[model samples]
Target: MGDKLTTKTYWESYYSHNHADKKHIKTVCGYYNDFWKTFIDSKNESSTIIEIGGFPGRYLAYLSSKFKLLPTCLDYNSDTSQIEASFRIMNVETYSVLQKDFTKYKTPQTYNYVLSNGFVEHFEDYNHILDLHVDYLAPKGRMLIMIPNMRGYIRFYKYLVDYQNLKIHNLKCMKLKVFKDFAQRHDLKVIHLGYFGGFPLGVHQKSNLFQKLIYKGHRLVFKYVANRLLLKKPSRFFSSSIITILEKQ
Candidate 1:
């Protein structure tokens, strides 16, 4: 009924307000860890990664540790002092934070990996965003786009728990076909595209006692039973997130 919450002001306000909260930072790091573990490997140890729209830099810190890459973070936020502080607190040895709008800004240097998580969905011109991300890739470089999947069990559970939960999502859902078509149009090769995170085990500081209990139960089940049963067939319709991995042509 009301307009979607997709403005830059909204996010700037949200991040500025919650940037200092340890629980929120932990949750973001945990989410990125789970999503990236499915793709990152030892082969990327020497690759250069640039994260567009990365603010408050937790995910960039994770990538630096996991892949041994000095990642560059580009965001449009007016102030990046807090993000810099976070990098220091995490003991991230090498990283660059630039204050620029990736949607329009051009860079002279390209990277081996262009990555964004939960970023593109906020913009209506998602096609343009994808093109910009592709433009930042070097030859044979990889691009990873991750967003929430609306058709997943997490959405169902959120709605069951609180019907208004969907309103917080600016865009409804990112369809898999949309990413495929975008890649095909740009002549990029799709290396990986699938749903992931079937269990709700990430950190959520605002969750009520019941929600926390549910997350804990899911973690136990995923570690003991679900991991073994779903080792070979991990793709599920009820996964919480959708990941698309692309390589330049």
Candidate 2:
């Protein structure tokens, strides 16, 4: 909590410089796709949704595309007007609230789906962060938390390109067991939880012949061998993220 990584100022700079208008990524792994449909109908246009720590609101845009539902973006750095303007261009109906600290934000409102992507792993008091998500969730609502696979083998690539960000994340929060235990501690129901999103070889690192061969070889195995045999199940060694879908109990 004392570290610069845990500070709101750090994240404000991060969003301002990097993802100010980052495009919403559409192509997700098959497992996530199935889980999406299993948890929510594609035609869903009425369920209330919220994305915490979503600044510049890219995931909000993505969710609008995925579920055809309007989602609220709750972030300290968010500009409701800017986000809504962008969504308007994209024909998405959305709203945003700018709040510096989610833990202290007062709200009687709860959402049907509460979500955060790459959010919890930055804090040492990650459990407390998770508690807030649970608190904002409506009864029977599901909260989806996704943390990057920086603790796994992919960390090497992340370190090579973005070591500052690598240090920004608390690696301890990336473990699958942490979320599983957290759900149990809170008496929440684990809808679906595990390491997900197939191998991430798309990290564009400067490669020599050796690295190129290694990456290409793994990409081949990931697409043809691993995905086929494992049914595209994500493993810690190759997965890009650890995702948990937990229902408030």
* Top of the candidates by TM-score: 2
Cα RMSD (Å) per model? 4.9, 4.0
Q: Per-residue lDDT for 1-249 in model 2, tens only? A: 353256766655545533324343343222366666656556647788888887666666666656876577787753355555545645675555555567678667888888788888877788778877877788878788888877667787566554555777788888888898889888999988888766665643366676677667777887777755444566787777888888877
Q: Residue 238's C-alpha lDDT in candidate 1?
A: 49
Candidate 1 ranges with C-alpha deviation above 4 Å? 1-5, 16-46, 152-165, 168-173, 199-237
Quote the lDDT for 118 in model 1.
83
Q: Which ten residues in a row have the lowest lDDT in candidate 1?
A: 1-10
List TM-score per model, in order.
0.73, 0.77
- lDDT of candidate model 2 versus the reference: 0.70
